[model samples]
Target: MPTHPHSPAKESVVDLLGMLAYGELVAFDRQSIDARLAPDLRRRAQLSIMAAAEMRNYQRLVARITELGADPQEAMEPFVQVIDGFHDSTAPRNWLESLVKVYVGDGIADDFFREVATLLDPVDRDLALEVLHNDDHSEFAIAEIKAAIADNPAVTNRLALWARRLVGEALSQAQRVAAEHDSLTMLIVEGTGDLAKVGELIKRLMQAHSERMTTVGLNN
Candidate 1:
């Protein structure tokens, strides 16, 4: 049977979906690497479990894309360079950095998805919403970030600087993706109903980051 050509609308939708699928794949890989920064076996295992869940979610998204007649790797290729650079450049040096990475990165991801969800149909939108990291992971991140700061108050200046650097690096990579990938950028703009909304989304992410850091005793 011949496959139908998707309309421009649907193609854009698929691209948006693909970008997200690729995001999940890269996130899984990076988090798996950062998990090694955990101080003990228990903490390591917790991070490993979270990383593995990303893989499972990635698989499901890939399967759905295949059903749409898209190549999983190809669909994700556009995002490869930016995401790869983000992870490589921000690679954590210790348990504290790792926790901050997860907290900040995942918080940013959840914000992005919430913005993108409006572009998708019901099922995929719901899937994106559902795949987000849960409260347990958030709680875990808050606890780890707080404990590390408590153990060494001197750690604050270093880790807070690390967090800001991580955010800067992430934004740099994201700007690259938005410039090079029109479809992905358009997805956010249209999906959220306006270009200005992206800034608001970012502000919300910053607010969340501040709350998370304050909860951890880090100066916001």
Candidate 2:
């Protein structure tokens, strides 16, 4: 917004962009790989299309980082470890698990990014919002998960537990990121302006997450 933004604000923007860009890259990779676990050609093709969307978003974000005079790779490097760790720890062991991860994990990720986008300037905020996972893209995964639970209600328990693990791992990585990146953390704290508002934001996110879970016949 300013001709010359404060150093911390600028750095925080770069950091957030970097994190988001890398996240899109990783999302593409995961979606591509997870597509292999799909039960049918149609489902696999759907996931492949979703994966391509993520790559396109990745390009947009990297271009924005370069326009800002930051090296996209360097901007993304600090987050690599934690991001990779999240995927490593939550690798889906089956087709259903992969679907659940895509539905729950990506849903929560988009919600969090949408929340963070509010802290950014108009241009960056729009960019951040653009890269968010589209619920339409997740329709296949959501339908599959819901169908599975409908056919076999007992499946809901296992999937619900898996969903919880995904959320927990995501939150853990977020905490690590906030601790390691001062500027980004400052942006969030300053943007929220108070702990009460921050808690409220969390409540909204959790509520959205719970509704998504319910849609798939899973308990939050």
Deviation in Å, model 1, residue 198 alpha carbon: 2.9
lDDT (Cα) of model 1:
0.78
In candidate 1, position 120 carries an lDDT of 72
Where is model 1 poorest over a 10-residue stretch in terms of lDDT? 1-10
List the pairs of residues colliding in candidate 1.
none
Per-residue lDDT of 1-220 in model 1, one digit per residue for the tens? 3132222255666776677787788778878888888888999999988888888778878877787788888888877777778888988888788888888888888877776675677667777787788778878988887777787788898888988898899888878878987876776776666779888877887887777667777654
lDDT of 2 by residue, 98-196 (tens): 888888777877888899887777788898788888778678778888788878988888999999999889888988998899888888877887767
The best candidate by TM-score is 2
| TM-score for candidate 1 | 0.89
How far out, in Å, is residue 18 in model 2?
A: 0.6
